[model samples]
Target: MIHSTININNNNGNNDNNNNNNNNEIEEINTLDSLSNALKSHITFQILKDTFNEYSKLIKYGNFVSLKHITTGKYLTTDDKKYLTGSRGQIVFSTDALPEANAIWKINYPFGSQPKANNEIVSYGDTISLQNKLGKMLWAYPNYKSPTSGHVEVSCYSMNQYNNWMIEPNISNISTKKNSNEEKRYLKSEDKIVIWCIELVEH
Candidate 1:
């Protein structure tokens, strides 16, 4: 089972606002925390093992990995396991638990550019896109059901930034290899770079 640690601060600042406004903000934060906890409780080790086994074969690119939310320590996942028929309204959410089938994402390089292993400068126009097992690409909207939702969704259309994603590996995983045949090859051809073994960590 996946576990998440959340820190909630209830400190009151010396502001001119009335007590009612502070109480309201506190209430909203508590509600959001409750929802996050509920999502975490649903994840179990069996579900994660099963999901990994089922999707292991579909992962082709070395960059393909599970995305962990920076703040929540949760994975991105679909609202349900049901198949979506290329609908733009398909819902995606952050889950405070191990990912299921819908959460697996394949990182794809920009069109016309060859894939590289090094952490080269990838512009927004050349940013990678995330594709799920269902063949839908991840999309984000400026305005959706709510402003706080971040407007993340999956779409069939291959739009610009809506489809583009920036994925950076955990800093601890980035290291240089010395005195190896692969390093010699990389020195000969800078274009041919190899990414060492990496353990995906929360952003």
Candidate 2:
């Protein structure tokens, strides 16, 4: 359901089998792995789905998505906070009322798989990377100095464990009489149902 564009340039082997041959041009292969990796480095902007769509498609591997701070109504922004004068940058929620270019992020699944559908919401596994448009990743550094200490920052994409984050829907904004725990679980399961329906339709 979620359509993502992935550009893969695979240079496996050249046409010439012998080393002396200059015409051994490398062939380009398109595979899931190549697509996934390409998606990581090539995602430049936000890829939002149509609001009118009934079911939310599971975000494909390497697709760009925006993270909206539920309470602030602001999107996650990159390079808003700088720890050092010339340091890479830090991640912060934008103060602007509307989403901006810096707020766009690419969801990176280091394990190489698509985000699973939980109810209508897409669930990234235990850990995922939120890579900003600037090619830096959102990182949370704890045990550091003040302000920057225990705060989110952006660093060069290194597939670091600290950069991994668990993304979940903000249930606090959901208005319901049900208990918080119950509501969260219900919503997740409901999303699963929506995903199942979409699967059925595809089949």
Question: In model 2, which runs have C-alpha deviations exceeding 4 angstroms?
Answer: 1-52, 85-91, 97-100, 111-126, 145-161, 169-203
What clash count does candidate 1 reach?
Answer: 0
RMSD of each: 21.2, 20.5
lDDT of 2 by residue, 1-203 (tens): 33445334545556456654444334344567655554456534123223223233345335556554444545446554555632334535454543444666665664454556422333423356666566666665554433443443434443544576654443333212346565422122122221121111110
| Candidate 1 lDDT, 152-181, residue by residue in tens | 334333343446654333333222345656
Model 1 segments beyond 4 Å from truth? Answer: 1-63, 80-88, 111-126, 143-162, 168-173, 176-203
Top lDDT hit: 1
lDDT of each: 0.45, 0.44
Q: Which pairs clash (backbone N, Cα, C closer than 3 Å) in model 2?
A: 15-24, 16-24, 119-190, 119-191, 119-192, 120-191
Quote the lDDT for 33 in model 2: 68
